[model samples]
Structure formats: C-alpha cells, structure tokens
Target chain A: MALIKDQQLSCSHAATPEMRFTDWVSGGSDAGDAVLANGADDLPSLLAQAGKLSMIAIEFDTFADGRGFSMARMLRRQGYAGEIRAVGDVAMDRIDFMQRVGFNAFELRDDQDALQALQKIGEVSVHFQPSADGKGPAYMV
Target chain B: MYAYNEFDQTLIDQRVEQYRDQTRRYLAGEIPEEEFRVLRLMNGLYIQRLAPMLRVAIPYGLMKSDQLRMLAQISRTYDKGYGHFTTRQNMQFNWPTLESVPDILADLAKVQMHAIQTSGACIRNTTTDPFAGVSADEIEDTRPWCELIRQWSTLHPEFAYLPRKFKIAVSGSSSDRAASQVHDIGLHLYRNEVGDMGFEVLVGGGLGRTPVIGKTLRKFLEPQELLTYLDAVLRVYNLNGRRDNKYKARIKILVNALGVDAFGAMVEAEWQLIKGQELRLPEAEIERVKGFFKAPDYLSAMHASRDLNDTFAEHPQFAAWYKQNTRDHKQAGYRIIIVALKNQLQAPGDVNHQQMDGIAALADEFSFSELRSTHDQNLVLADVAQRDLFALWLKLQDLGLARANVGTLTDMINCPGLDFCSLANAETLILSRQVNETFDDMDYLYDLGEIQLKISGCINACGHHHVGHIGILGVEKGGKQVYQFTLGGSASNDASLGKTLGRSIEQDQVVVVIGQILDVYVEQRQTDETFLQVIRRVGFAPFKERVYGTHQRSAA
Candidate 1:
C-alpha cells in the first residue's frame, strides 16, 4: 500500500507493525512496535511510551469528528517525535489540514491516488494559524 | 473596516476557487453526497428543505455599500430577489441552487466577502455590537479585535472540524448588544484599573435543546494573549468534547461535564505553553487594524439645533420616526439610523433586492458608504448627519424600510422556520406577520416600549429565543404546531435565560396570547415600567395567570 511521507508519494512503502491502544495497555500483551489509538484515548497512557514507540497511528475514523486532529497536535506538543500516521477515511480535502496539525505520514485509502493526495497538502500555501506544523502564522510573521 | 491586505485577499480569492473546484467535483459525481455535505457546509452552503441556503458572512456584521449592492445583484441574478439577514449578523440567500453557489461566491469575492465559516462545525463569523464604533456608551471599539479574530479563525486548521459548530462574540459596550453571554466564547473587552485593555472571557454558553448562559472562564486576559487563549480553549474542546451523541456534542456540554474551573485550568495550562509565543498579536498589527476603525470625519457645518426642532414640529411622522428609529451617535452632529426590516413586510428579516439596492444607495449618500447589520435582523446606516435625518426618513418611507419600529413590540427576532429549514417544527415568518398585524398601531406600540420578542421554530434557538425578554419556541405535538412562551429573559449586559410559561398556545392563538400578556403588563406596570421590568417586578405569575392560570381566561 502507498503511504505519503514528507509530501512524497512512496508507492511501495509498507506500514510498520502496530497494535491497538487497548491491546498495548491491556494487562498481558506484547510490547508492540506501534500503538493504534482513536480520538477518545487518554494521552497520559500513550505519553509514557512516547519514547519507546516507533510510531503511533491515530485512527481518523471520521473526518467530521475532529478529535484526531487535536490528538495529533497534543502528541507533537508532548514531545512525541515518532512517526504520526493517519489512517481510515483519509480523503484529499482533509490531508492538508491533517499535515498542518502534525500528521506526517498518511495511509491513503485504496481509492485515493497517492500522488494527487500528496499534492493536496499544500493546496493553500498562505497560513493564518501557527499549528503543529512548526510554520509561523502569516499575521504574526 | 479593516481593508484586506494581499494575504487576506489572496486567501479569500484562493478560497473562492477552491470552493468552485469542490462544487465541480461534487456535481460531476467525483465526490459523494456524504463527503460533499461537509465540504459545502464549511463553505456556508446548506442543502436545506426548499433549496440551498447560502449564508454569506458580513465579517462582524460590517459591510461596505458596494458589498450590499453586490448582494442585491446576486439576489436578483441567482436567488428569488430577496435575502434573509440572520441573527448572527449574516445574510442568507434562501433560494440559491447548489451549482450557482460557487458563482455567487465568486461574485462576493470581487467585493471582499466570502461565506467561509458562516455555517460550518468550525468557528463561525465573530460577531460584535451592530453599533460598535458609533455608539455613545461603548468601551473601546471592538471592530479591530473582531477583525483580528475573524482573520485568525479563517480556515484555522485545528478548528475547522470541531465536534459541533463554535460561535464567538465580543462586546466592548456597556450594553451587550452582541449577545455575548450565549456564545461558546464571549470576549467582554474591558480596560483594567491601570488603563490597559484586557478581555473577560466567558466560555461554554449555547442555546439548543439545552440552553446555558456562558460562565466566566478568565477574569482578565491580556490583549496579546487573545488568539493564544482562544486556541487553548478550542484545542481543549476539540480533544475532549463528546462525540458519542450529536445533541450533546457542543463545547457547552463538555464545559458543564468537566466543571468550568476544571476547564479553565486545562486551558490555562495549554495557554501557558503557547500564550506569548506563536499567536501573540503584535502591537503594530493591532494599531494598524485600529487605524481602520477610526470614527468617520463629522461634517463641520454648525447648523443651529433649533432649526431641526422646528422642522420636527412640521412633520409628526418624521418626528416619530426620528425619535424611534434614530439613536444618539458619539459624534455630536451625526446619528445612527436603524433601517427596520420588521415592517408588516414579507417577513421579519427578508429584504427584497430593490430595498437592498435602495438602502445601499441611501448608505452611500447619507451614511459614509457603510452599513452594519444588527443581530436582531436590522440594518444600520450609521453616519447620517442629524440634519439629513428627515430627508433620509422620507426616502426610507418611500422604500418601505422606515417601519418606525426600532425596539417596539413589533420589532421581533423571528427565524425562517418550517417553510425553508428542514430542522424546524413550525412556520415562523407567517407568525411574525400575524404579530405585526395585531400590533399595527404605532402609538400603542410606542406605549409598549422596548420589548424583545424572539421566536424559533424549534429548540435549535436560531432566533435566540432563550435570551429574549419574551421568547417563543415552537414544537409539534399531536401533529399540530404549538408555540410555548418564555418570559423575563435578557440578552443584554445583564443576561439571563427566560423561564417558560405554563402551557403551549396553538398556532392561531399566539397573537392573542401576546396581546393578553402585554395587557397584563400594561395593567400591572408602573408609569415608566417597560414590559420586561413589569415581568421582573411582578414575576411570571401574572403572565401565566393571563394565559394558563384558568380556562376562564381567553380561549385559544
């Protein structure tokens, strides 16, 4: 499956092994390489493993529910430098906003063209807000 | 009044094109309806009951005359020759087709307007007092701060897809004309004892099935920390607000769930990390924006005030209109004329294309080529000279815009209910007409002074009925529309939610009940007591007794 990383469409890149947040935090489960968390998951539990985890995949179950964007932003602010991958219903319209709020890697849906979705990240270059992308807002600039 | 710079212009221009593409994709079957609904909503296009309603933002309710002309032109070209001004101080074309919305937006872009964030689940238009800069008893001018918020929240990446819609309002006046208390974030701009400007921020207030008055989140916030603090609050809401139920998903529910103190603490912690850093508004930028809102130059002609008084004696209708529709401006020679959209006209807030063009022309000639739309669904021609008021009133009378009912009983805030909106349970425009017809006597209306009657077709409270002194909410029961009345609410500085009266009146009995309620107020009131003061003085008992205390009362 294709994954968009650093604004480039990597056609043959395979996803890292990951586990659900419940499985990772469950009493007797293996230390998965990556943890899959939804918007409702508490960050304190995930921040403890922020150092050891190779990646944390935040499920974008619905674009309308914006908890994923907040989780991604909070993940960056809490010093999680690992790959933050977006999965589930990741459409082109939300891709640019996802990147601005700190989604670096995306697992594009099968029907979406990886290249076209990659081009969506910079659709509107002018920025009004300084978000998790580390770019300054134009007004402040 | 802040003119769009290159960045602002470029962003809006690109946004128009982007919306055009989205429309193209949606119409061409490249995007599904489920996905297109969200996109169209974010662009302020609602696939409503009758047709697509296009709500265009007035950017804190301030519009240039040319922009009003553009709206008139669009109404004539695309809509059904009229537009409805909403309580958010925005205008909505009720009959635009889905395909024509992009072209309408393109037309709006030529005049520095867009519908972005007007109806989305994101931050809607930041509204302030309609008499913002020109009012007599205002704190500081709130337009500059509103412009700052307007720009900062435009396409804000983090806030674009909130759990539900977020509304922010600011009031810098002693009287809260903006209805700041019922907003998600109500910024009460104030000056401290040390003479520095700060904000008293209120959070979590909203009106729907569940109504709440916002609680104070921060007692004092610095000017520079405005955007940052707002960011912290939004981030907190976006992260922790409920997603399980649609009805319980507003930020108000989250604030009440986790107490206001807890919400404030979390916001403080998040705000401390980014408060003075990223979104800190620069002093130069604030000053630059403030420069745009400087009061217009007053004409230096020193005409004797006695001449206008003599002219008023000659025309009693003009005198009544001058007294009712005009307000004292901060400038000595200037006055603020409220063009009432609540005549026995078509509907409460609907202005025809010809009236829109006429008002635009009047604004260009009398006022300073500027107009302000009030949240109560009226337009303001703010900078008219006091001497020109009689002439202006005559012209307004010709256009049927001078209803001479500024704050009287007929000046009601009514929602376009079941006829247009699928969310409504009953019709409101016709009810509004009935009320106007029942209270047609101007002298009697003048006697019943300053009554805020707000009505909504459903519990969504689009008409802001919760805060009205006399609020009416419609509901469907036994397949019939019945409207319940709430009493003693105020959306002013002293904000309070009204208490619901005893029983729901049938559709035809609303006007009669209103008449009986006003009669009770008149009977019990002191010499100078208004309807609300009488309600507060005697409590809701009298109004209840007048309506549902006994069947011996008037029958519906």
Candidate 2:
C-alpha cells in the first residue's frame, strides 16, 4: 500500500477510527472526529459537518466509480479545509486527476507503488483545464 | 488540425507509457481481467470476436495526408492490411493483438493521435459537422470548440467513468450534418441577432435500445462559457446518473426520469458556483485555438469552371458522379468531394492499405493535403478545386472509390457486427452485400433519391440504426438471426426516431422484405418525393399492410 500527500511521499498519520456519517451525526460524537463517506453519501449533509471534521476520507467502491470526485469537489467548494483523502482503488495513473479534484491525500490499493505514484504527478507540467486546485489553465498561466 | 505543443505532446506520451505499464501488468496477471478491461477500453482497445480491436480517434474527423498515410502504415504493419472507418468518424483495426496495442499507441502519438476516450463509459470523441469550415451555411467553425472540448474531456478525472458511454457532437451549419440531436450533449453553434457566436445546448439525446432526441438545456450560451457549462452538466450526471443497471445508465434515462426542466435547473444551479472560475475560457486561448482552423489558400481567379461544366456536358457518367458525390463549398472555386468507401462488394467503410495510400496521394494533389472522415462512413476531400473535380474523379475511379452512392440506398451506415464485434448478436457483412447487390443500379438508386439505410447487429446502435430512414436491427431469436425493420427515422434538422414495423423476419427474407417495401413506395409516390416524405405523407399503414398483409404473408 502507498500513501501520497501534496504530490510527495508522506508519513502516515496516527490511526483514527473511521465512523460513518450517520453514526457521526446521530451518535453525537466529537465534532473533530474522522469520518468516512462512500460515493452514495448525501453531499449536503456532509457539507454541513465539513467544518467540524478533522478529516473526511471519501471512499471509492471501484476505481471506475467517479462519484467520489464530484463529492470531493463539493466538499472543497463548501469550505472543507481539513484533509480530504481518497481511499481505495487509488491507482498511480489516477493520482494526478484525483489531486486536481481537491484530493490532498490518497490511500492507494495494496498493490500500487508509492514512488511511481509520486513521480506520476510531475510527468505532466500543465493541464488544459482547471479543477478544484484553483490553478488556472496553462494558457492563463 | 491543431498542432500539439510540448504540453499536449508530453501528456499523450505519458499516457502511452502509462497504458504500456498497465498492459504489461495485465498480461503478467498482476491485474485482473475485470479491472484491466475498463483501463483498456478507456484507451479504445476492445476484445472482439476474432481479435482485439483498436479505435483511434480522428478528432472532429480532420486528418492531414501524412496522418492518413501513418494510419495506413500502422494497419499494414500491425494488423491486417485494412482499417474500417466507423460511423463515429473514427477508424478501427479489428485484428490487432492486445499485447501490441501500446506499441500501436506509441506510433499514433508520434503523429499527434491516440485512441483515448474513443470508447468506454466516458466522454468520447467530440464529433462535429464534416463541413465545419467549408460549408456555405456555416455560422461559425465548430471544430475549434470541438478541439477545446476534446482537450478538457480527455483524461478528465471527474468523468473517466460515467454511468455509460457519452457522446458529444457540434454542428455549426444550419444543415445539421453532424446529427447533433442524437448525442449525449449536442451543441449547435450559431450567431444571434447581434452577430456574436454562441451555442444552443442540448442534453440527454442518444440512440440505443431507448433512442431519444436531445432536449434543449440552454437557449443560448456565450462561447466562452462552454467548458464551465459542460462541467456543470457532467457533474450533475456523475452524481445522479444510474449506476445499478448498465442498460439504463446513459444520461438520457437520467434526464428523462428527472424531467428536462429539473435537469436544467440542476445544471444551472451548479453553474452558478463555477461560472466565472478558472475554467472560463480566456479570449486569447479562444483565438489561439481558432488560429489553427484558418481557411486554406485557394486560387483567386478560378470561380465556376466552364471547362468542368463542358466536360460534364460531354460525359454523363462524370455528370452523375458530380451531382451525387459533390457538395457546395463556402469558397467560390472550391468543392467538397465525398470519396465513397462503399464499393459494390466491400464492407461499408473498409479501406484497404492501397486505397488509404491512394486517398493520401489524392488529398496531397487536389484537396489541400487534408481529408475528412464523415459520420456516414465516407471520406471527404474538403478543399478540392472545381476545375480539378474531373481529375479527382478519374483518380478516385482508378482506386475503385467512385461509387456515386453518397446518401443513396447503397450508402448504408453499418457496424462491424458479429463478424468482428463480440457485442454483436448477428452477422451483418453478408446482409450488407445482399442489400447493395439488390439495389446496385445507379439509375435506379438515383431515382430513389436520398435514402439512409442503416443496420446494426444489436440494440447498441453503434451503426446508428435508430436514426436511419430505413433502420434494420439484427437480433438473435431462438438461436436464429432475425432482422427487424423500422421506418420514418431521420437524423437531420428534423431528427426523429424510427418506429418498429410489425415483427422481425428471417435473415434470408430481409432483402425480399426491403424490396417489397420499396415496391410499395414506387407504386404510391408523387414525382420526386423521397421515401421518407412518402412515408410521412401516407404513414406506415400502407407499407406495413403490404409487407404483413395477406399477399406478402402468403409469399413468406
């Protein structure tokens, strides 16, 4: 398994138990607790708790299931300042795009390579379109 | 064609290596079959019945002569010595090995081409009117906008895996040759009263088991807001489009279920947040993209050629070919020549290596060194001089490409079918040949003017059968191939889906039934009325009764 943060290899954070959005909301857990949301989670409800959560790790059931990217963009737009990580199915080739859509951390599948994923981010220096990263397109740059 | 700068080149090159590594892992069994299938499909590689098929994108169907030659060379060296042009304005090689696909992509990258996003559940190649820049009816050249969308959608992270395959088309001409109404998102470029170009956006149109014409989402959108609005629409679809059932997963179903008004509201709301963000295209970049599509040079003094008309007067064969296979160009001295690939016995779009080479040479000599692949499985020399039409026709005849079947009954839009496609339910090549032979006479075909006969092996509608004037869908019934007929469909400005006839018939009866239907049209038509107009005027009752009524039933 590989962990990449801010386009580089990073040390793992201290372990925190992941709780569902329903459990975190109904159970009256601490506001700053870590929470996990799948692609199917309600985005408005998640955004309601974005400021309180320390980290929101959106899980991808399958790599091809791209609803998570939308969810991540919504969270970022809704003022989620804490770490927003992508969990599961994080292949190396998908890392750059994941980063573009406001994924600060990626927890790749067990078989993926971290160094390769880190290097992949630098392969393309400029992209034609802008994303949640707020970096303008290459032409504007 | 847009030249690839270093950024574009590097990204494509990186994608080649990335796919290469993925192919290596998949072949090594490190990646499972199910997992690698999506990856390969995103790169336009499909596992077909006979061998692996690779669909290379010809962006908006524009290609230089060298690029055409490169495609012919690839077909010669990698697979069989032929490539099939597709109804989506792309090319497919049906006999390549899975192991060699990356090497093929590497070669394509050398020529600024790749197969990325040609297939799979993603935004596909953005097609446009083949006569984008050269048509007399054009309001704005749509190819530059298509190229913009192409760059934005290629390898887009948020849309790589949508509910199902997505198609976008742009039509700049009033004629609607790109079939924009039958795409996932259709953009019609036009000038408002003030003469500033904008787009009429349509969403949720598609052809499949459930064929539908797209609905207008926005009456008019400014040119600079294309990508932002598209992003908003895609974001809405990504989050809400059905993923449980692949059959009902296209954006059309979602749009239908939600209602167009509600869908438009959602996209409008989403657009409010990202409207003026970084995705808004700058004026400079728009001009930069537009600069790539500047008009080619033409001779100033060569208006309507008297010599050409004289030659046409002397030779009726040349006159017939000219009338059927040529279109009016925007430029005074230029003409767009349709190079028909549907020769008598050949597959609809199958071009052998020699034909490809011949096409390249002809393009270099007469058509500004550029050629276009049309949505109807034909090639276009978009910038031919009117005076050179005779020479061009002669050269095309030598290559066996002067079939004079553009928009005729024999110029059918057909899929590769079960002969090559693993997804097909029945074979279609023999049926194509049978139908062509039955309607072979040029005089007879010209009399039956402007018939769009499309055939698909299944309901996937890769052949676009649903929009064909006489649509034929081949299905497997009780382990036997059956062909069903449909009527009154058209993919033009008046876009409508074909309604199914009574029932399917055996494969052998397909040609006979078509003949009977044509017989009815011949017997009960006003002078110079098209088959579609006659059907619209009289309805399908007369034709259906003739086919399914007592007289034809007894023969069956």
Candidate 3:
C-alpha cells in the first residue's frame, strides 16, 4: 500500500495501534490512534478526545461511500489539527478531493501508484469549495 | 446569461483534461470499468442502450447563440446530426463514442460549457426559470443565484461522491415555472414580511421510485448565507443518508426516515456551526454575478412592432403563431418567443443541427444573440422585438421549428426511454409520436388548452410523470408493454401528483385510452374549463368510466 504525505511518497510511520470507536465506547484496554468508521454515529464523543489523538484514520468501506468526505470536513471544522488519513478503497482519482476536504495523508489502496496519485492530487490547481484552511473557492482567489 | 470569467474558464479547461486522462486510463485498462462507471457518469457520459449518451449542462437553461452553434457542431461531428433537449434544460447527444467524449467536452469548454456533475452521485446543474430575467411576474432574476449555486456545487469536494445524485432548483417567481417543489432542494425567492428578500428552502422533494413533495426546512434563509445553509444540508445528507440501498439513497428518503423535523434540526445544527464562515457570500460577488444578467441595450428598440397589425392583416397563420408561441416580456416592446421545438418532424425536444443553426441565426437577428431552453423542452428567444415576431415565425416555420403547440397537449415531455436509456422498461419516443399523430388536429389541441401530458418509460420519472396533468407511465407486465394513466397533477404554483385513473392498457390501445379521456373532458367541460379544472370539478369517474368502458364492458 502506498502512503502519501505532503504531496509525495512517504514511509508509513503510523504503526501505532488504533482504537476503534466501538472498542473505545466499550472501554478498550489500549488507546493510541482513533479508527473512526464512516457510519459511526459517535463523532461527538470522538471530538471530545480529538485533541489528545495523534491521528484519526477514517475508514472508507468503498470508494463510493462518501460519508468519510463529510466526516473529514467536520473534523477539520471542529479544529482537529491531527493527521486525517483515508484508509480502505482509497484511489488516485479522489486524492485531490480528499485533500481539499482536509485529508492530510492517504493510505492508498493496493492497486494505485503513490507517484501517479501524487500527480493527480496536484492536478486541478483550483477548487470551488473552501479547503479546511480556507484557501479557495476559486472566485476570491 | 452569466458570462464565464477567466477563472471559470480555467476550471472547465482543467476539467476537460482531467476527464480526458480518466477516459484514457479506462480505455487502456489502467482503470477498471466498474470504477470508470463513476468517473464517466460524473462527466455526463452514460453507457446507453445504443451508444454513450453525453449530457451537457445548460446553466439554468440559458445559452448564448455561439454556444448553441457549438452544440450543433458537436452533435454533427461526434454524435448523430441532432441533439435532444432535456427536461432539466440540458442538451444530450445520444450517440457519442466513449473514446471521443473528451474531444466533445473540449469543444464545449471552448464555448464556456462543460458536462461536469450533470450525472453521477453529486450535485447537478441547478436549474431555474428560463424566463428568469425577462419574466414580468418574477420578484427578481434568479439566474445570479443559480450561478452562485452552480459555482458552489461545481467540483464540490465533499459532495463529489454522495450516496446518490443530488439536484437543486430555484424558482424566481412564486408561480413555480422551474418545478422547484419536485427537486432535492427547492429554493423559492420571496420577500419576507420585513421586506428583506430571502428564500424559503425545501428539502427531500424528488420524482423517482418514491415521489414525495419537498418539505420545508426553513421559512426564511438569509441571502448571504445561502451557500452555508446548503453546505449544512448536503453535509447532513452525506453523513446520514442511506448507503446500503441504492433505491433509498436519495436525500428524499433520508428526509422521510429521520422525519422532516429531525432532519431540519440536524441541518440547522450544522448551519449554526458554519453560518458565517467562508461560505458567506460577499455582497460584491452577488452584485457582480447580477451584473452579468442585466438587461441588454436594446431596451426600447420599438423598431416596427406597430407594424404587427399589418403582419396580422397579411397572414392569419403568423397571427396565430404570434398569439400562441410568444409571451409578454417585462420590457414593453420585447416578447419572449418559445421557438416550438416540440413538433411532429422530430421527437419531443430533439433538434437537428440545421434547426440549431436556424434558431441561432434567428436569435442573432431578432433576440440580442441570447437564447434560453425551458424545462418544457422548448427554446426561447427571451428578448425578441415584437416587430420581429412575424419574421422570426416565418424563419422558424421555414426551419420546421414553429408548431404553435407550446403548453398544448401535443407538446409532451417524453424521455428517450427504452430507445436509448438502459434503465427504461419500455419505449416512449415512438409512443409519443403515435399520440402526436393521433392528436394532430391543432384546433382540438388548442381547445384542450394547457394540458401537460408527460410520459416515462419507467418509474424513474425522468419525464416527471408524477407532476404531469396527464401522466403516463409505461410498465412491462407479462412481457407486454402496458401504460398507466394518471390525472390532475401539476408542476406549477399549484403543485400536486396525478392520481391513477383505472388499470394499465396495452401499447396500441394507449392512444385510444388517452383519446377517450380527452373526449370525456371535452364532453363534460364547462366553458373555458381546462382539463385540470374539469377533473377537479367532476372527479375521475367520467374519465375512468370512458377509459375502462371497453375492458369492463366485456368483463363486467
């Protein structure tokens, strides 16, 4: 699997064990990163501990399941500065969109090339919606 | 029409390149067909029954003459020598090759157009009144707001892959000419009691497998915060809408599942958080978009409209065309000409390349080089001079574009159906022709008056069968195509769904049933009462009895 960070190929440093939302609510033994599923309804509880977490790897069960996109946006809007990684079914075609909606790192699916995905993420230099850092919407820019 | 700025042009250019790369990859087997399906649909390329159908956005149904010419050129070069106008006010080339779609999009980009988000699970082209700026009864022109929403929805990062396709429509006037009540999100422009112009927002209304009229989310949404409010609504749908069931994934289903009150609260909570953020429209941007839609300079070109009497005196046919195919414009001397594209020579809304060029030339000579397409599947010269009506009518007649059938029963909105669409259960274009030929008498159609006969090949409702005054749905029972008839629905200020009359009828006999219903209306109508008025007054017993008389005659 290719890991993309800062618009380039990067080694996977996120080897820490992550806490699933279900496990955390059920009182898991260990806590590291937060693994938030797209369908998880306990985002408010996760937000309460968002500051302490180093990463929130949002799960995408399928490439077409777009709940992760909105989840990333809400996480960023709530001022979570930690890395938001997209895992599972992530591909090069949607890399640019993931970045625009506040995904800082992408754990690409097995088939996609890290180098090609990087080029695609930087392709369409303008976006219509504002990024998490409020960079665009193309009109004001 | 909102002119494309340099930024807008760049985005479209880049998009063409992006879609080109995606198409190339898919063709090269680098991208699988399953994944490519989503990508191509996002670009409006649908793998149809015959060939790949390409749907190009006509932003809020407005197009410049050059753009119309470019569409004509594309249809000639890549597709068949014709293009079809859709109920959503877009253009469709029914026979485009998948390999050559990128080239077509590139050509569209040259004319400041694209097929971005016309299909797929994303926010689509936001439509409004074709007579937006020129309509006399509108509170104001809604094209600017449509443009604003278009920009906001274009390549929207989060919404690119929603659970289902999302559609939004704006109504400039309270009369709902844009069919706002049957959209995913309907924005009604109105002045509140305080005299501040805002919007009454409706969510979850759609015409599909389960047709539901939209429910109100907010009584009034402040103008500047339109984008923010929309973001909230889309976010709520994206977050909570069903992903498991494809049929129930539309926002309408989610609205019903959560109930409108709970759904509205969720959207309201999200809006409270993002209310005045970057999405807040600056007064300058709103005014800047408005400036692009301002009235053309030929405001008082009272050139020879007074000679209209002379034209009337000369040709009775021209007088009939003038009375039926044109409407009063906000500008006194100007008129909005509904170039009758719904005639016998072609299918409903189909325009050959020559007809497109003819309409473009007519617009250039008479209507300030601007044109508009309506949801009714007709073209409009929104600012034609009254004096030019006769000349325009003559030119349109020569091109076979004048039918004097606008708003009449023969001017039907028919989907491509099983002829092209893969999702269709039956064919509709030929059925539409059969009905047209059966009701070819113009005087009878005119006497019937303002009847919307919409047909759908399936329950997907692309033809908006739910809202037609006379809705016809084609379903296959026992491998035989049969049709169900509905009565008394409308897509106007008075919005309602048509009710089923009796049972399904066979294809050959569908025309007989329709004729009997129309005959019933004519037989039972009071003076000047429309089909809807007669149905509302007398209920469906008369229609049911006549439509089922043959079936029940032998059975009962």
Model number with the top DockQ? 3
Residue range B353-382, candidate 3, lDDT tens digits: 999998999889988899999998999999
Model 2 alpha-carbon drift over 4 Å, by segment = A8-11, A123-125, A132-136, B551-556
Q: Which segments of model 1 are wrong by more than 4 Å?
A: A25-32, B301-306, B549-556
Clashes (N, CA, C under 3 Å) per candidate: 0, 0, 0
Place model 2 in a CAPRI quality band: medium
Listing candidates in order, what is each one's chain A TM-score?
A: 0.86, 0.89, 0.86
lDDT to native, each model: 0.87, 0.88, 0.87
**RMSD (CA, Å), each prediction:** 2.1, 1.8, 1.5
Q: Is the docking of candidate 1 incorrect, acceptable, medium or high quality?
A: medium
Q: Which of 2 and 3 is ahead in DockQ?
A: 3
If ranked by DockQ, best first, what sequence of candidates would result? 3, 1, 2
For model 2, the local distance difference test gives 0.88
State candidate 2's TM-score.
Answer: 0.97
Model 3: residue B111 alpha-carbon error in angstroms: 0.7
Comparing candidate 1 with candidate 2, which one achieves the higher DockQ? 1
* CAPRI category for model 3: medium
